[model samples]
Target: MTALAVTITHEPARTILTLDGELDMVSSARLTDTIDAALYGGRQHLVVDVSNLTFCDSAGIWALLRAERTVSAAGGTLELANVQGILKRVLDLTGAARAFRIITPGQLTSP
Candidate 1:
């Protein structure tokens, strides 16, 4: 299994976290830590780019949901970008897609 990798980029108005590898139970904490750090740093808008993510399990989905809730409760917004293939299918299958603000990569570049 590929190890989980997370790269965080801070933009003027938002923070973007690019996730690669498997987002399973073992790697969920990294995501959670990244989310906490971003929010704690006063970032209100967070964009999680999962275009390079190789795999995602139920734990990953739960982590995403938890991050969304945390951001929302803090009066912030969390968006998932470049979500495709299996990850997208998983979200659809779980009926959890509607709960998030999904966007394309182009949207992130727009002013």
Candidate 2:
């Protein structure tokens, strides 16, 4: 398992958290930490960039769901930008595809 790193990039009015590496049992906490920080910051609008994520497990899915709920509870919006690979398929199969505003890298150019 690779160490997951979440890079935070501040957007105009939202915070973009770019998650790279593997989100498995070994490194899921890194994701939780970064996402929790974003939520606590009260940014509300979150864009999770998972394009570079190579792998994910159930823990990763749980992390995403927890963050999604947290954002909604705060009356904020959460979106997923650049999700692909197996992670994308799982989200779709689980009917979570509609829960997030999934965007591609090109679509994020508008900021």
Taking every candidate in turn, the Cα RMSD to the unseen true structure, in Å, is 1.2, 1.6
Clashing pairs in 1: none
- The candidate 2 region of ten consecutive residues with least summed lDDT is 102-111
Give the winner by lDDT: 1
Stretches of candidate 2 off by over 4 Å are: none
TM-score of each: 0.94, 0.87
lDDT of 2 by residue, 3-101 (tens): 788899887788888888887778877877776787787777888888888888888888887778878888888889988778889999999787788
For model 1, give the RMSD to the true fold.
Answer: 1.2
lDDT of 1 by residue, 1-111 (tens): 448899988989899999989998889999999998898999989999999998899999999999999999989999999999989998999899998999998997847
In model 1, the runs with Cα more than 4 Å from the true position are: none
Question: Clash pairs of candidate 2?
Answer: none
Single out the weakest 10-residue window by summed lDDT for candidate 1.
Answer: 1-10
Using TM-score as the measure, the top candidate is 1
